[model samples]
Target: MSVHFKKKAANAQTAIPTASLPDIIFMLLIFFMVTTVLRETTVQVRTILPQAEAIEKIEQKRLVTYVYIGPKKLQNNQVGETAIQIDDALVDEVTNVRTIMYNKLTEQPRLIVSLRVDESSEMGKVIDVQQELREAGTLRINYSSKRDIEGTL
Candidate 1:
């Protein structure tokens, strides 16, 4: 005995429904919107980071806090002087750095302070920041720098 398939429908629907696509796209948009971390604070300070022979990429972005130290970017470089910036605020006194960093450390115990120091900035300022960090007990620090290329084509 032989079996045969029947195909005798003339008005049957054959096209796939397109109604769910917009909902799917909307869901994806919402998913990405929630997952992405928007940059809340803009880096207002001008820091020309020094060069280094070796460098490593940070694995965790959330575990890092940036401390900007440089000659304040102003209309005239001569008028404005070197300053320390934490988060979005400028620290008028160096002593405030320790308190701020200590608070941050309490919030995030594994936080690594990344110091972005300018190449032309005075070394004394950096030493001061380091001393503050040491007092704050934020010893796990990383110096942000560019890769040195002396004799490269």
Candidate 2:
């Protein structure tokens, strides 16, 4: 007798069971959103900071002292070129800056004095302030700068 061939039906595909994929991705996103650390940024009067070819990263938050330089009026009531202002008063000499900085350093020995001198400040004044800080045993000093988005120093 001639053999009769029977056609076999194709088997149906197994279910992928992808219902947990969205849940898994959503859980991961929530985990990262909760566990990620966001750094706190310093805010103050905006000033155009001098650019540096080499910039170093500041890892820790320490005590900051702002030294502002703006227009000043002499005893004669005549407005003169900007002078360094420490805590709102005019800093006519290095001694004033030194005394204020020294007091701050004493309170926080590990203070990182952030010098925010104006762009128009005299280089000599800036150096003088730095020298005084060095003399007062405040070695850790940072110059605040405005950074561009490209990450250029």
Please give the CA lDDT of all the candidate structures: 0.88, 0.68
Off by over 4 Å in 2: 1-47, 56-62, 70-80, 149-153
Clashes of each: 0, 0
**Per-residue lDDT of 139 in model 1:** 96
Q: What TM-score should be assigned to candidate 2?
A: 0.54
Question: What's model 2's lDDT at 147?
Answer: 55
Q: List the lowest-lDDT window of 10 residues for candidate 1.
A: 1-10
Q: Which candidate is the best by TM-score?
A: 1
Displacement of residue 34 (Cα, Å) in model 1 is: 5.1
Cα miss at 99, model 2 (Å)? 1.5
Looking at candidate 2, what is the lDDT of residue 27? 99
* Cα-based lDDT at residue 56, candidate 1: 91
lDDT string for model 2 (11-105, tens) is 88888989999999999999999777565433222344766646676666446566654445455544467567665455678777778888888
Residue pairs in clash, model 1: none
Per-residue CA lDDT of model 1 for 46-65, tens digit only, reads: 88888887789888899999
